[model samples]
Target chain A: MSDQEILRTTGLTMRFGGVTAVNNVNFSIDHEGELRCLLGPNGAGKSTFFKCLTGQLVPTEGTITFMGEPIAGMDTHEIVNLGIGIKTQVPNLFNGLSAYDNVRLAAKRKHLKRQAIEKTFDMLSNCGIENLKGSEVGLLSHGQRQLIELAMVLAAEPTLVLLDEPAAGMTGEERDRLAFLVKEVTKTASVIVVEHDMAFIKQIAKNVTVFHRGEIFAEDDVKKIMKNKSVQEIYLGKSADAA
Target chain B: MEKSILKDPGLYVMVSIGLLIMIFLPIMMDMFAIMQITQYVVLSVYALSLAYIWGYGGILSFGQSCFFGLGAYTFAVASINMGSTSLPFILAIIIPALFGVLLGYFMFYGRLSDVYLGVVTLVVTLIFWKLINHTAGPQYAIGDARLGGFNGIPSIPILNMPTANGQMMDPIQMFVTFMAILIMVYVGLRLLIASEFGRVSISIRENEVRSSLLGYDVRRHKVVVFSIGCGIAGMSGAMWATYQTFIDPNAFSLEMSAKALVWVMAGGVGTLAGPIIAVVILQWISLKLGQLNIINNFVLLGLILVPLVLILPKGLLPTVKQWSQDLWTIWKKNKANEGDTIIKESETVNAGRRK
Candidate 1:
């Protein structure tokens, strides 16, 4: 176990009803100081995998170790306490509270002191919403809310941050900014981003995992996965003739 | 920069004024009328508790009345059974709080969701109501008095409050006693709403999944928040016991639950101040309405509620907020235009002098 390899899962499996959402999958990462992307098409079980790792859903069969501690059966709150933070695919924000307040709530969980308030503002500034902090998350643009959500997760100071579809509703410029922010986040903690957009994956991810139908289809450098023929076929479909 | 109404001076002023009215209302109004308002306010506390769960925690509890009833019964039984005459009022309060904690532990640890939790609570309330109603027969005796069936524990001892004179309190004194408690409870709730716990509760309401993912003990938080709300409901019940000097199974009925909810709804759900305002207004109206023929009373209620519901879905407070905001904005805009015109004229005058 290295400082970089903060989380690892062995033979993780998740089933819903009769559908095996995540099949037997063994994956580990030697933590690098950069964001990693788990890219897959719809029905590829990326979200399910993220949920399993975050303890939002229990894996039917798996051993998850966070910083060398078994976290498979731990509750979500306990997992978070052990330095894991998750940003949902949908912008899961308190609509009734201002953006600042949403971030403040998360910050208080990390620590509840006046000094923590400054750190929370710093986190919000990092996410590029320090100016619009007081505006309600409901009133914010889709991009701004996403940024606030990012700020919220950052406030927790987790060693491992999982973001699902963070830039789903963001504009191109917003997406680019988010990618940069994600890269910055990786400087302190390993960020595993589950996203569909290739552009974002290419921009931020130093390493990429292409998940295909509940299994790790490919895991390598971003450049290598993009060039891999089978990876492209499975993700983008075979060439026109083959199709 | 994270300024909220809680920090606003105007809010403090408004709260102070409201407190003042509550403090003096009993002196100005008839004893029975003031007692009725106090009961409604107590129910509002229950409503506020529900609002905390529903509006902030995002956990809908249909059986909130369970806690309310539980608190009331706990206080009544404990104080009565112990025969501790000196601190009956205090015992009444403490007992309910204990019940809240006990109930919270069961529901929260059980991992109950909103729908199932609500059903369980409603069933519990009904069961308790039935049991109490049925058990109030021949066997239930306290000292010399017999527990009246369908009729509740009547002749509840007058709440013994300490005053400067060291004399025992009359019924009017009990009104003052409960009124003081109501104010204190309101203030405590206000502070709680502004505390770190309150923030967590609101966050849970906003996004339980996300809040949980961020490391909140969502289930435990729900249970604790629910329990706290119940505890407050219990406090109100204790107050009710003191104010009316009576306790009955009917006090914990479906109608009581509905009225508590109505207070929350008629007041603004999310805002703390809204529940208080709504309770006061609705209680006053309902009292006035009750004076009319029963048939006309309900019809009149519909006439008022229809327009109120239609016009202010956020309740009266939102309407007041909107109206106030509009006025402030117009005033500010006018001030800005005037300043701009003055600046333009001054600039022109400066140019003329240069020429």
Candidate 2:
């Protein structure tokens, strides 16, 4: 992992109607292969921040630079074209298509016809659902669909990946598997994961950023973040007892 | 998943049956019947355009007759001025396609939702209907072709061969020509839907936001597909002019657009054979109903469409395809179970003999 900033957001703020979803804040990813976890409560503005990064919503005030270019107003497709991948909270797979087809569709955008087919199989196997290639995505279990969505994002071979609550509806075993998968992904790309599960975060994240009331409450290593008094009171909500 | 023509037994069977009917109908029937069949063939082409956009592209255009009527008028005006069918034919296709490009750019790029798209298109069709109906005065003439308004332009020139004297095509030649065009369009559409572009278009239809996140320009794809559909509709309109030897403002009416939609809905939206089959059967029934004096044909059409929508919401062809596939799976499972039982019995018998 090299010391190069892949993405940076300066003084980002997003307002919907009269409510401020994400207050002005500066965030940056300096290492190429670092796994950063975003921990926040519901409505902590983590989703809004993720959306701003992915170009789903333009921030009302701020400048987001990706790979040294301003991307605050770029379209979602344009952002993806710049080698950034996003997996929203919702498993937005094509329900009528098979698992293979879902990944194949994403692969086709960045690869040739023959290479797309090969990459699709490779990613599906990597995600541990190669046997379910022929099954429709709608027929798959929640964990299986989540894994497929991850495979689809990986198939594009992006340099940066953003995932929002990928383990929200998974079993304990599934979360363990997801932790391994996220670790494996960071070997090739920088990753920003928005999650609320403390155990899952401890397993996957080395660097943690806690958010509260649309602001960054704390930022540090997992051990220190869990030990911090303010983070425990505002985010963990139990002080030392929760720790 | 494999897109080989041979893999779809239904398509092969339908095409074969349709070809046989096209070949033998003229020999078995009178000239008037052949002419009516020719009209149905042209209408089938129009229905195909709707299916391409609505079924495959997920664009439910309500004013498709705008393109069709534009094609008819372009053919009439060009043919009257040049006294040749060749240039008019080319213009008929090109004019509507250009118009489609213009309309689609605004609608798709403007990010109009499906419901808004339907409303805008329907309003455009009504505008065309009103605009053309009021062009009945003698001043509305374009060169030698008069805009006959509600009465329509009569004695329009038929399609002619490109030879020196430009011999006019008779009813038989026209029927064969229209059938050939219909087949070509069907085969072309089938190949397109099987291509990579077609797969991406379907993905966009399934989920536009997901497709965009996957790096697809959803707006551009929609606009291109819309333009192609409009061009095809224009071709059908040109054929309509040649077949009837007359052009009318009714071609631009709401009824014409509604009928095209009905054909697609009654047949099946996505499959090529669905709309073609639906148009032929329904038109035949409509002609039969027309012979009776008691009931209006449109009312009878409404009656048939209501039941069809209720019973086969996915349309006839897709539902039938699903049923056949389900049956095939059940049969395969049953055969596997039978084989397992037979093998188990044989093993037990061998053990008993050894004991």
Candidate 3:
């Protein structure tokens, strides 16, 4: 696909109980079929920014345009309909529902016919979580739940996916698998990943936006953002070994 | 422990026996008494309605009695005025469904949460009961069929099958008439739940947030399910009017609503069979208690409900399914143990022959 701006936000700001969590941040990402990482230290407003973009919260002052249509006032459901999907840091699968049913719920939104269900079954196979189909999401291991969540978002056939700490609670092998899955999703949809893991970021992110305080400290390729002195101080801290 | 006998076929045979009893029940009893049984069957309609919304749509409408009352009163008044019972009967069911649509619009679009929705329905039911009870008087007559208000509309003509000479039919004919309506309503309900709309209702109950994210108009689904559930309840109400030939504000009181809720909760919220099994079992017990001349009906209700809750919190059907599965596993384990013993005995005999 040709590069284009699928989602754009201007002057995005969020305040909760008089504390400014996210300041006016002007940001846009062009559809480059590549993973873009939003990196920040603790309390850098990374998650807040993602939430605003995904319509989970109405920004105090900002206009979010998705696919060239204003979506700031849209509800979370409407935003999902507008082709933006989100995978939360926590495995937000319905505990009582089987893994297949969880993904089937999302898939039904796209095409709920019998053929569509078969297609969803295929997607599950691709994610290597097909055997867990009959298992309740609550019963699944952490790594397995992540796979189910990915399958669910994919089932919606979203044009853009906002992954908040997709590999937050995973072993090295699990994180690598998640990195591979994120890269694979890029072939079909633009992926925005918010993560602090340097190795995972380097593995998937083609472009990186480094956040500090409540603003973007740097936006560039992985190598430049990783070596930036301010980025090092904010994320890696003063110790050289932190790098 | 033969595996074939432990299979689903045996379970299906049990269900068939239940169905046979249901079909033959009225024939064995006096038709006048059967008409009384029809009242409970009508209540089953309301219970099933509650099941669809509370069990499938995840709405515990404490005001379901409101729709039941609305339908009963509408039919009673219309039948009295028009001097035609059928017209009022049809109107009764339709009006309540429309009422449900309007109520659903406000409750759902207002973004009212579950607990508030229950309160709103409860408040509405109480308000209607109070209004109707206070106003019912002797002068409240529609074409000579008196709307007794608190005394209730009484002696409304039981529907008669008219012949060419305008011959009026008897009570047995009325029972047959209501039975037809009951069967049709029951089948309609089954088909409705099997449709795409039914699936959406179940989905909403499972997860409203997820359903919305999947692009379903959650408010629309809620309204539709609410209307359908209320409509079924209204049909039952119409049936009640036909059988009793009398309806008062008491018919729509909080007590009735509470009983219906108890029935649905004890039966199982999500399962279709829950309400049916609950109705037959609970109503049978209530009937037997009534025979003993018990003034404390509430005590009888508590006796059945408390045990159902304590033993089968997930509802009767889920509990039964779990127990059956456990039994099958135990049987299979015993059979495997016996097979192992026989195999070891055969091997020892072969060793003796070799020696």
lDDT of 2 by residue, A40-102 (tens): 889999989998988888899999999889999888888989989988898889999899999
| Chain A TM-score by candidate, in order | 0.92, 0.95, 0.93
- Per-prediction DockQ, in order? 0.66, 0.66, 0.39
**Candidate 3 residue-wise lDDT, B54-172, digit = tens:** 88788889988999888888887777676667677788879999999999999997778689999999998999898888776666566656666688877655554544243344665
Tell me the interface RMSD of every candidate, in Å: 1.7, 1.0, 5.7
Off by over 4 Å in 2: A13-20, A23-25, A58-61, A112-115, A211-218, A227-243, B5-15, B163-165, B325-355
Q: Which lDDT tens digits does candidate 1 get at residues B170-239?
A: 6566666655666666677767767768877877776778878777788888777776777777667766
Docking quality band of candidate 3, CAPRI definitions: acceptable
Q: Give the clashing residue pairs of candidate 2, or none.
A: none
Task: Return the lDDT, model 2, position B276.
Answer: 86
In angstroms, give how far residue B53 of model 3 lies from its true place. Answer: 1.2
List where candidate 1 sits over 4 angstroms from the true fold.
A1-4, A32-35, A96-136, A221-224, A227-230, A238-243, B2-15, B22-48, B51-56, B85-88, B105-117, B140-148, B162-168, B294-299, B335-355
Question: Can you write out model 3's per-residue Cα lDDT over A88-197, one digit (the tens) per residue?
Answer: 77766777888888888777777857866886797798787888998989887887888888888888889988888887767787787788878888888888998877
Q: Write the per-residue lDDT of candidate 1 for residues A1-243, one digit (tens) a residue.
A: 235577788999999989988888887756745467898888899999888887888889988888889988778899889988888887888897787878877887768678578878898888877888878788878778888888989998888888988988898888888988888887788888998777777788778888888888888998888788888877855431232
TM-score of 2: 0.90
Which of 1 and 2 is ahead in DockQ? 2
